[model samples]
Target: MIDDSIRPQLGIIGGLGPLASADFYFKLTRITQAFRDNEHVPAVILSVPQLPDRTEAILAGHDGPLAPLKAAVSTLNALGVACVAMPCNTAHHWYDQLAANSRAEIIHIGDAVVAETRRSLERGRVAVLATQGTLVSGFYQDRMSAAGFELCLPANTEFQACVDSAISLVKAGSIVDAAVETERALDIAQATGADAALLGCTELSVVAASLNDVNGLLVIDSNAALARACLTRLGFGTQEARGLPTVSRPPGHDWPMRGSLAVLA
Candidate 1:
């Protein structure tokens, strides 16, 4: 349960792949502390796990995925959420379409990541480890390029398999399998000259553990960034709430964001 002290209900359009939606919610919980029942932020999550595969639809030019995604956005907007966050990074490819149809402001994961990436690195190529759908959409490349940053990606085959596997494991709730693939994806990124990895897929954030597991490679967790942004917008950052309870958690163990690597891994 979240505290009601914070206002501005958050709406999430999720289940592009269920794992991603879960990841976002888990992070939201971890970002705020609940001293009383109403001290936490309020949120409404429309977890529609039945949406068709977004990557397949985008790559194959199918319409099934788009219809449901649009429906989700409309439903959330109708709920009157202050702002909407889509946990799936790949879904941001439809930024314009979703934003046009929904009244809720779309907090773009890619744009936020790009902004944070630039601030973190002075001049270095940052690689995006995301689903092929996101790659084809060019959301990261386009946004990061606009910010004067180089974008690197995995090979087509590797990228597809990595994303597919991550999705599969996450949907089945197998956090370990998801993490294994995350390490492999990072290894591929290292070989490709990536100075850092964008846990572009929300599920990958499960396996990757706060973007720091890439072995010295800076990781950018979009969900975390969104939480911070949400908090700032909620007026909790004001001096009056300065000492209020904060929602903080160790990386990867939190549910929705679960799937921490075992001691052996």
Candidate 2:
């Protein structure tokens, strides 16, 4: 086990949708560089699904979710976490509101997703598949365009309805149904001549396993990206924590492994 006394603890301000929060934690644990159980991230998960609907609050310009959300952050901060992660993409519309008086640094979900998308495609149309609120707020468009990606919304209301259906199905514990809708959304995305697709909603990220690089569209998942960002910020990327070998491979040696690059050592 590694010494964690000096390491920062991670906090999650989740449950904008219960399933998405659970999936966010799953992604965070899955991608961590830990080799042992004790080496995993020390995190505080506050899953209060009762918080007011983020999408509704944003579209209506109401602050309904604000008070409870601040309380959730306060609860986590009081527990001594160094940084906070809110996996829900729609909730990020209130990101600045939440981060202003926060004791713990709030991690912005778009930064990680945009960074990953930028790395994948320097310039191209990236399908923005997310909640109506996120789209209405121009959240992904504003951030991704700065990274040189032209964020494309599926040209019709039906596309967003499909995505919304998919998100609802997942939240209702219907993964199979959600996968079907997710597939439909991808089909619409492909119609946009997109080079990549951004799974900007954490609920969509839950069924991200159902997505692949099929048809040459690079799928960027916001939940997974944010999870990775948490690991980096919390110091889990340290050489000692990852336990990478001191021996360097020969310069000409090929790294034969899966794309995820989860080191075997």
Candidate 3:
């Protein structure tokens, strides 16, 4: 249990895709090595799915997401959180800006995933599965390459299309189609001779689960990695929290889609 006097508070600048933000919170709570309520990390989540599409802005060379992302960080800072974490992988393209605006430490999902991969494997080809924005940003590619690991990108444009489809399906509340498309993307990554596949997008983490990896491929969940990193950074128990980074929903509440609230309309 953490002492009340110095218990570090966390803020989640979520809703990059909505469910991904909810999923990140669920992972953070579920994986915590807690015996009771006080053992878990205290967090506040600002789930505003109203933010502009990060991928669109990135690919088109627009700075549309910068204002809202920085605003979210400022809000969290005003709320007095000690650290902030955004689950979206592509949004890390604006990480430098977000970090610059925040009074708290903003945890980069890409950095957490890359560091987790380095810890899990000595040196190997890493297949990165992410949004086109993330790929175009070169945040993961540059960092991973500099870390001395070979990278296995999508086999072709079609592979990334499948990933994009999967991410969209999940956001639209189409879980089955999302899983099928996610499986397709994973299958393509597996054949790239890579030792492990990184689910670098938080949307991809929505359907992350145990699979029968015939080739013994290692799969890393970026959202879970970031959640775990948050735990470690906040002085929470993590060493013996959970076994695997399984897809978990925290209890009764369903994660709402982008415009799920009829009352708001």
Candidate number achieving the greatest TM-score relative to the actual structure: 3
The lDDT per prediction is 0.68, 0.76, 0.79
lDDT of 3 by residue, 50-79 (tens): 989999999899999899888888888877
RMSD in order of candidates: 7.0, 10.3, 8.6
Superior candidate under lDDT, 1 versus 2: 2
**Candidate 2's residue-wise lDDT over 1-265, tens digit each?**
2245634388898787887888788777777766797888888788888888888888888989888888888887777789999998988888888898689999899998977676567798988888888888786888887887787776766678888998888888876567667666776677757778888899888777754334666888888889888888877852311221122224443223312222322
Q: What lDDT, from 0 to 1, does candidate 1 have? A: 0.68
Clashing pairs in 1: 3-38, 3-39, 3-40, 4-38, 32-247, 33-247
TM-score of 2: 0.84
Alpha carbon lDDT of residue 245, candidate 1?
Answer: 29
Candidate 3, residue 204: lDDT = 81
Please report the TM-score between candidate 1 and the true structure: 0.79
Better of 2 and 3 by TM-score: 3
